[model samples]
Target chain A: MPDRLLLAGLEIRAGERVLVRDGGFRVDAGEVVALVGASGSGKTLSARAVLGLPGPQPGVVAARCSVEANREVHEPWSGVSEAFATGRLARFRREVEARFRAIRGRIVGYLPQDARGALDPLWTVRRQVEEALALGRTPGRATDWLARSGFRDPASILPLYPHQLSGGMAQRVAIALALARGSRFLLADEPTSGLDPTVQAGILEEIRATSAEGVGILLITHDLRQVHRVAHRVVFMDTGRVVETLDAADMDRARSPEARALLASTARIAWRAFA
Target chain B: MRATLLAGSAVLWLVLLLGLAGPFLPYDVVTAVDPEAIGLAPSLDHWLGTDHLGRDVAWRLLMAPGAFVGPGLLAVAVATTLGVTAGALTGFVGGVLASTIRYLSTVTASIPRFVLVLLVMTIYGSEGWLLGVAAGVAWAPALAEAVHQRIEVLTRAEFVLAARAHGIGSARILLFHLLWVNGRRMVGRQALLLFGYLLVLETTLSYLGGFGVPEPEPSWGNMLAFEFGQHTANPWGLWAPAIAIWVTVLATGIVSEVFAEREHA
Candidate 1:
């Protein structure tokens, strides 16, 4: 019943433009939260803030971001986002890196939007998975972890480098590496954005199954259809602010003007696809 | 696979070793001047003929390789170390520091190497060790600058950045991954370059009366400088030491080229 992560009155600024303002949200344990918005709606910035990855030059105003688990606050550095404004980002980076190292593989997993670019070209798939495990200091057997991640032939997959694998295969390897660290919170930034529909469905389903295992997921994306299928709650962002937050199940019959406008666009796109 | 080429290299190395070992050989007759054989042309008694001083030119030629080999190698070793280390650090760790070192390298390299060697020899009193030091000083900056440029390009590579992200220590990254990996080709090239330069440096210094002590100590360069007056009458006097210097430089150049090409391939 407690929140796993909470961002209160968060404001993220890049130069003079407020990328995200009055952005407050939370993801509860074992919950899937979808962040839906148009491009430049600050959905990505909000998600990045939650993970403590600031933009190139971000200024945060009036933020109280916290991550709690087991009914106790895991991270409670009030006004910590102010570190970005004071030109202390480097120091903040070191602190975040240290904390991230401690919790990254075991407590948090990240699936970045640019899946291919995130992987090392020289390293084989298996070595990367092993590196993730070693980096996180995870305890469970590596073989069991690989099997659960849906890798059919761990032996063959392990030796092939990133360039040799297809987009879907590489994404699967990325997910495997993220999970290999035994992280409980999976931050998936458009996990299926660049994949074929069938492969996308398979990846989304894998994400769903993984989330069911007490791992909370914060899915940052603009696809309302994906939100409908996998998300428990929907947080709508507009012009760098959270315009609305509602139950995902009630989104279909929602009557708010912004919601109606979004739904109309989605329906139009869906109709065109079927035609 | 190439037996003849490998065998040829081996034979060349064997000959070089024998030439180098001439002074230390058990023969007590090195530099034994026979006044009776003075100015004699090439014959069975005095192979390669006798010098103006009546010394056996064959023995002197054999011993000449030892003089060049010792100081030449010492200069190469010093130059290689100084150049590689300076170059690697300057290029890899760029910024104001790199700029400063690079600037210094450029200035030193721009000075005529012979002039620099002469200045160093004059300052240090022209002893054999001083000559070696002068040669190293004259050659190291250029070689270091070359090495620095190579390492700078490699440092910005994505693979290096990935390695850094993995939390590998800087020393290991530089030495094992960056410097060691990229240094083989550069060092090979520098070694060959240094070999040619050493011959020239030694030759220049000995010609100027800066090599070894006074006479009776026969350096190839000193012999050439002294025998130039009699060269037309006795051409072998100049040919013997000149040929030795030429062959050594040529062999090193060939080996270096082969190494450079292999690295490129």
Candidate 2:
């Protein structure tokens, strides 16, 4: 009913170099927003800034940013987390952090780009998933989430460490960690980047199924084909600025040169696949 | 290297054996001084001869571990706890606070180690706790600086970012994830190095004649003090205690090297 996430009047500057100038977007509950772009585009930085990864470097500023701490309860979420405790990484306002604290693992989840590297190599899958649940204060069996994330045999997989898991399996475990925390909105940053196509398809299907269940996802990917197939709205970015926003239906009519180039590249990939 | 390791292990084990046997051993170092046999060459009756006080040099060497080991262990334990806590907290919570801590450690470290020991000695009255407190304070700053550098590197590690992204609290992440996971081996190596420092410090104090356990206590340093400048003629009196100190220090050095090598492997 309300916006799940919002970013308006955003400007990112590193020294004299402006990375993102006048960039902003929003996603309501139960919607897929795929941010598409080329290399050195501001897509990843935008997502990281929202997630509060790096502190605003010494000479940077943000105009407006807000996240729905709990969409169902209508709690307030405002102010950048960098201000909470910079060296500690991400921490929001006390009330906002408290509300979001109640919501994360249950309402919002983050799936990092490097799924295998994201997992602690020394820890078993079971321990990692369980700790996520503990941190999220979510009540669910870890095995159920593992299965929900498409693990056929969670019992066998849970005992293995990250090293023992194949690329696809590690990616799935990352998803399971998100689901176990009660994630209704997933911020997946290239969930299938390095996996084989078959595995990539399976992962995409899981994401689609997640969306079908009314969970909003801000899918960060460079793949236009995946964007066409999954994203309801495509927000195209170029050189750190949001240059175009298009409905999935109007992709062929992409107005900007960058968007058109993305379409053409995906067209080439599709042709290669068929030929 | 293997032979060095064996030699080191043997010297350490021999010290431990003598330490265990010290209270029960037959030699009465203070009263058994054979005035007639004083400065006699090494023999069955007196295995390493006598000092100027006519006390058996071997008897004192055997008894010295009790005096040396307790203070060394105390200093190491206190220094490690303080150093690790100081370095870890400073490194994790960067900014003005980090700079302030770095400044404090620099100030503390800049004071010469011997001066700091003397300061602690004067405060605590130079009794059993003297060496422990003095050396503990003296050693902490350097160890803290080393750990600070190590933790700073870990802050940039991907796993650390991943942990923060997952909503793990800052304290848990700093302690369990960053410090505990990586700092364990480095702490152990620091302990071995500190033990060697404490031993060397205590012997130096005894050799200087004012700071150690005092007269008739039989520390390696004081035994050397008793025969100062006489080793040219009565080398046995000087060399016995000197060899004990050298062997113990050398053993610790070898053990520390092996520890580092094993870690790299």
Candidate 3:
């Protein structure tokens, strides 16, 4: 897959139930793929699988997964059972984990679902931004990224802590942290659910801006309006499966009952009330 | 709040100063044994009255900081250091290691730690350093448990996930980002709490006459315990060490509550 993140076969199981089974999807560079479904459809879990997080699950298996062509595709537990059998111990999986960590923030940055609590409550905005910059070893470029994220006077905002900032502002800072790594792939999980409607639009604009700059965006969300506004394509998922993938322009033509139900729900949310 | 914090800090600094200055203070009355001065009421020559052995009670009271505060500080330092290290390692590197640490914390917490302090002093002899070691060892599990929980919560935090995604190694994330950065406030609170705990432990252990600095070396615990030993019901002398202990404990608690809160924006 050229300029895309591809996962051929991915399975995640906790104790008994598989959260995501036989699931795979891709987000090409500069493309936005919104994984839309009702709660617990494993949309967020599927994105986490890309980050090598095994979830709260005991085991996760990914036979093939990749961010772009020629980039290493991690399979953390591919040989786990085999490693258990040969008495060679958990060595292969350790290497797999190390390799996975080596690529995490640099290759892929995540904006977590819980925006209000995403930044450490104790850390100043400046300190957090500096840390993110320093992680990529470009510590002096805080103002550059802060401006890119749309902060007009970064000096004023930098001294404030997470709790001091509005939910919308905090979300932008989180996005800035992710982009600070110069990640090619961005994972935005419910990035705007808990913010003011006006603020939500601004945050979406930031995400849109990031995508326009060529970052592949995997937008995991339930709001279909966000899907229409930001996503280039939507992956309709239900009960641990990728039910369908269609262009955002074709969302009205979605045929699956789950897709129709989600679209109908989004339509039912009156925009006039927000106005 | 600011007033309480200031007052508590003043008391704490005073106690610390006394403890550090213990070596320079005149301690002649600690070993003074005189039948003539026994149970003497307060006189200008013998301030705060003399104890049963005629030792100057004020001089002994001055020794309280050195005898109790020193050991308490050492124990809190040792326990917190060990606890933070153990908690960070176990929490950051999960699997058998995390499980094992969880089990160890459980085992240690289940024990009435004070009993362990007593037992160690009983078995290892009544050396002051040994008592301090026992106090530190006994409290390590409590700190370990607190830090373990803090680290686990932080590991799942979105910020930490962001850090990890940035290709920061697990060690850096655990020690610097998680433990030091996120966990420092928690450690401060724990330190203050442990200081109070050690204060109580040292006093209690000393008063019970087991590892007490042994009468001549004057500690708050023995000062109070010394009167009850002689059945002398003089409130003036009895109240001296009692008030010291109470003030120290209260100051530690107030300071912790007021100042140990994490610096938030």
Using DockQ as the measure, the top candidate is: 3
Q: List model 1 lDDT by residue over B54-121, tens digit each.
A: 77777776666555566777788888888887887787777798788778878888899888877776
TM-scores of the first chain across all predictions? 0.88, 0.86, 0.89
Candidate 2's residue-wise lDDT over A1-275, tens digit each? 55477766566777789888767667666788898888778776676555555544443345566666454643322444355336432333445445444544456677888888878766789988888888777788789889888988889998897878998998899888877766667788888898898999998888888887777888889998888788888899888889898787787899899888888888998899999
Q: Between prediction 1 and prediction 2, which has the larger DockQ?
A: 2
Minimum summed lDDT over a 10-residue window in model 2 chain B is located at: B22-31
Ten contiguous residues minimizing lDDT sum, candidate 2 chain A: A73-82
Displacement of residue B257 (Cα, Å) in model 2 is: 6.2
Cα lDDT, model 2, residue A23: 71
Highest-scoring model, lDDT: 3
CA-RMSD of model 3:
3.9
Per-model TM-score of chain B:
0.86, 0.87, 0.89
List all candidate RMSDs to the true structure: 6.9, 5.5, 3.9
* Arranged by TM-score, best first: 3, 2, 1
CAPRI accuracy category, model 1: incorrect
Candidate achieving higher lDDT, 1 or 2: 2
Cand. 2 Cα-lDDT = 0.76
Task: Write the residue-wise lDDT of candidate 3 on B167-217 in tens digits.
Answer: 677778788878777888777777877778777777787788867678667
Off by over 4 Å in 2: A1-3, A22-32, A54-106, A120-126, A139-170, A194-202, A209-214, A228-232, A247-250, A269-275, B1-62, B111-128, B223-265
